[model samples]
Target: MSLPRNLCHGTLDEIVERGGLTEVTGADGGPYLELVSSAFPGGQAPVGEARVFTGDSIAKVVYVGLAVPQIGLDSHMVFAFCPADVAVPHFTLDSVQGQGTYAFHLDLIPRADLGTHLPYLDWAHTPLDATYEEVESRPGLMKTAIGPRQFAMMSPWMLVHRAEDEAFRGISDAVKAYLDHWFSLVEAGVPAEVVADVADTDLAARDARNRTNVFSPDVDKVWAQVERLIGHEQTEAVRGLLLDNCPPEVSA
Candidate 1:
């Protein structure tokens, strides 16, 4: 009955199956990265599970689900980071349902600077304009304010909003469209002209810096909540897991 949870799980399964992704076991020798806490004031414990995968074209794929039903909070997020060899944008989706509130964030995180790489922008993002506009126009959905710096890190085509239950569920089609487009980009490989002179090391370095900025506490306030729920140590571990990839670290 929870649309966000269902969508996240389904997407995770499909990607792992079709992409030939290999699941990475946690430090506990468990299959998933788990977090549990009883930090809530009313004795409510929040439980979270994070699944990580790796594949040839994708450096890392993370699906995280957290819920504290007593407080009416539930969130699901999926992030697919592209390999350094290609300049394809990373795919991300976030869906949340809370008491009297529903929200989601969908975006393709760019690997190159879109402002300067006009061709890359066109090739990776232009096709989503129609779908973005359509989703924006849906009834009972309204923009959820995000910081300017956060916006600068993500693509202009991102769909982030709060919506009614009906409007929230209506996004399944748009999610599918975006996922299909991303998959195609990964499969077809990046056009050489789109990133003509950039070396693989440079691309990897850029991606690392970008991920740091995007997930930093200053840029994403949600980390505070996560830390509270899972403790500071575990929270940082999760962040590191999300940021870490198969690419060798580019030397300074």
Candidate 2:
């Protein structure tokens, strides 16, 4: 896919002067079509890392990429969501084509150690075919032919081709609206019986179990002791109190 027309780059100095990487804003106060990075973490090359081009552009994330700009000698660059670990690539015009489109993948800390280009790699990925093991840090750490993996530790960071509106910012408002409606229904005295639902699923139990999957056996036992100290019924009662504090207007 092609790049956004508004996409533009400034020198490291210019970005530093302008308050670093940020979502572009128009006079009307709109959201970002894409965010920009003027500085990388730990000071790695800001224009040449492959991980920057391969990761997701939205959500809680960190990535690396090869950044290209006009006016300088062409070179392999590194850019990231965090401070750089090395110098960003200064490339010739001939080598700048489609450099921004490359994606970030898992890697290591770069040779440099400060300013905007710190190398950050993904934790690990679950395998296509694996058996899940019950552990403490997670409730189900899957074992693969290659190694141990956890779905909780995995995030697919593929980008959408240009023109995929939802991938950028299309459906966020709609999802929020739908959630508001669900909360409203529950609060409106609409009996879940009329809604044809049985007992609310034990989402907390499931979540607690998942949290244990990554822990060592000793740590898991320790966490269990801590939970017992808190008492299960009291925890549920606290959750109920939280639910009761909901706003009357939205969840009505």
Candidate 3:
């Protein structure tokens, strides 16, 4: 079977184009895509990294790709970050393909407590719920493989499933629908005055929550491998960009 390169890059292209995001150079003087040669065990192949875009809406993206020969370990992660002021959900798509099995975890993660934020949930949650149900009703799709801790960061509409041939088209359609809905949220974002009214403590807590999600143990394991291959400085640079370390004061 041919490699499903489109599963990663094609989706990213659609996101950038639809969102009208512009490409920007990352702090490392590269276009967000760093070549990490030591990412694979035994230094077999260089991982292709691409930031894709960092737009005026304060949305940032990172794409990591690895294809190891013979062992058939091909994986990709596309993480999209929105600023705290936007109060919109951040997007994450993680997929691993190996030995004729495909695993997927895709969601628009909420930055705050979904249960308490009725307005936010009202604005975004319903569509996600409908989509999740539609996908769940399909045959041969396994439930999402996430634990309770991870579940806390996700909205009620997250899609986590495993499948063989059936997964490819189903996941592609879900990605398109979810992203279109998210782009609408970006388009109809809160007014500046409303954003200004948001309490500092609220913003700080949101930042903390986002950081916790990004710096999870699973993420750390991946970083450790990258650090071992690329060294501390480069690894930290990638982490900072992905997590967006800019202080709220500075951002404002």
The number of the candidate with the highest lDDT is 1
Arranged by lDDT, best first: 1, 3, 2
Model 3: lowest-lDDT 10 consecutive positions: 243-252
- State in Å the error of residue 168, model 1: 0.5
Runs in model 1 deviating more than 4 A are 27-29, 41-46, 197-201, 247-252
| Local distance difference test scores for all models | 0.82, 0.23, 0.66
Candidate 2 lDDT (Cα, whole model)?
A: 0.23
* Residue 198 C-alpha lDDT in model 3: 42
- List TM-score per model, in order: 0.91, 0.20, 0.79
For model 2, residues 16-85, the per-residue Cα lDDT tens digits are 2232333323223442111232333443233321111111121011111223353231222222221111
- Give me the runs in candidate 2 sitting further than 4 Å from their true place: 1-167, 189-197, 200-203, 210-252
lDDT tens string, model 3, 1-252? 333456767777777776777666556556554556655457635555656566655467766665655456567777777775567777778777767777777788876566665555667667777778888888878785557766666666888788667665567888778888887877788645434434333854676666667666464466775566556776666666666634211111
Poorest 10 consecutive residues by lDDT, candidate 1: 243-252
For model 1 the local lDDT of residue 140 reads 90
Clashing pairs in 3: 33-49, 144-160
| Least accurate 10 contiguous residues by lDDT in model 2 | 86-95
